[model samples]
Target: MVAYGFKRWFSPQIQDGTKTHTIRGHRRRHAHQGEELQLFEGMRSLHCRKIIPDPICVAVLPIVIISSDLIDCGIAYIEIDGLPLHRDEIEPFAVSDGFSPDRLRGIAPAALVASTARETMGRFWRSTQPGSRFEGVLIRWRS
Candidate 1:
C-alpha cells in the first residue's frame, strides 16, 4: 500500500471524513485509482500513528498551482487534470484540502478569515516563493 503522512492537527478532519483529498509534490511512482492508501501522522517519527483505516484511492490526477503576477493581491490560477478551477469553486476546494480559514487560525494570518480561499491557498502555496509554480498530484478518496 502507498502511505501518505499528515500533520497531527489534521487528524480530526481526516478521521471525521471531511477532508478526503490531499495535494502533494510529485512522487516517483504516483498512486493509482483503486489502490489501498495508508494514512499516517508523523511518518518516520517516534510519535507515528495511523490516522484511519486504509482508504481506497478513488482518483489520482495532475494538479498545478501557479501564482499570478497579482499574487500579492491574492490571485492565483489552479488546475486539476488540466482543467482550471472556476472562481466560485476555490473555497470549497480549499476546504476539502483542509485549508478553511477557521481551521488555519494560527498557521495563517488573522486577515485570512476575511479573505477568500484563493488568497489562503495562494499565500500557502507561495509561502516560500511568491511567484513559484507547483506541479503536483491530487489524491482523493471516496467520501
Candidate 2:
C-alpha cells in the first residue's frame, strides 16, 4: 500500500472526508488508480495517527506550481494536467484543499473570513521561493 502523511491540521478534514486530495512534489514512485492508500498524520513520530480508514486511489494528475512576485499571490496559480485553473475556480479549489482562511492563524477574524481562495492559496504557497517552479502530482482518493 502507498502511504501518505498530512499535517495535524488536516486530520479533521481528512477524517470528515472534506479533504480528498493532496498535492505532492514528484517522486519516482507514486500511487495509481485502484490502489489502496494509507493516510496518516505525523508519520514516524510518537504522535503519529491515522487520519482516515484506507481509501482507494481514484486519480493522479500531473501538477505544476509556480511562484512569482509578479503575481498577486506569490503563487502564479497552478496547472493540473497542463491546464491552468480559471480565476473563478481558484477559491473553490483552495477551499477543497483545506485553505479556509478562518482555520489559519495571525489574521483578524474579519479578514480571516474575508480572504479569498486566491489570497489564501497564495499565502499557503508562500513557502516556495519566488521565481521557482514546483512539479508534482495531485493525488485523489475516493471518500
Candidate of highest TM-score: 2
TM-score of every model versus the real structure: 0.83, 0.84
- Poorest stretch of ten by lDDT in candidate 1: 107-116
Model 2: per-residue Cα lDDT over 1-143, one tens digit each: 89999867667778878889999887778899999999999999999988888999999999887766576654566799999998677777877887677554433234323356566666556644344687889999996
User: Per-residue lDDT of 27-135 in model 1, one digit per residue for the tens?
Assistant: 6886789988999999999999999999999999999877765645354667999999987776788778876667766754565443555567666666645456888
C-alpha lDDT values of all predictions: 0.77, 0.76
lDDT of 1 at 117: 55
C-alpha RMSD for every candidate: 2.7, 3.3
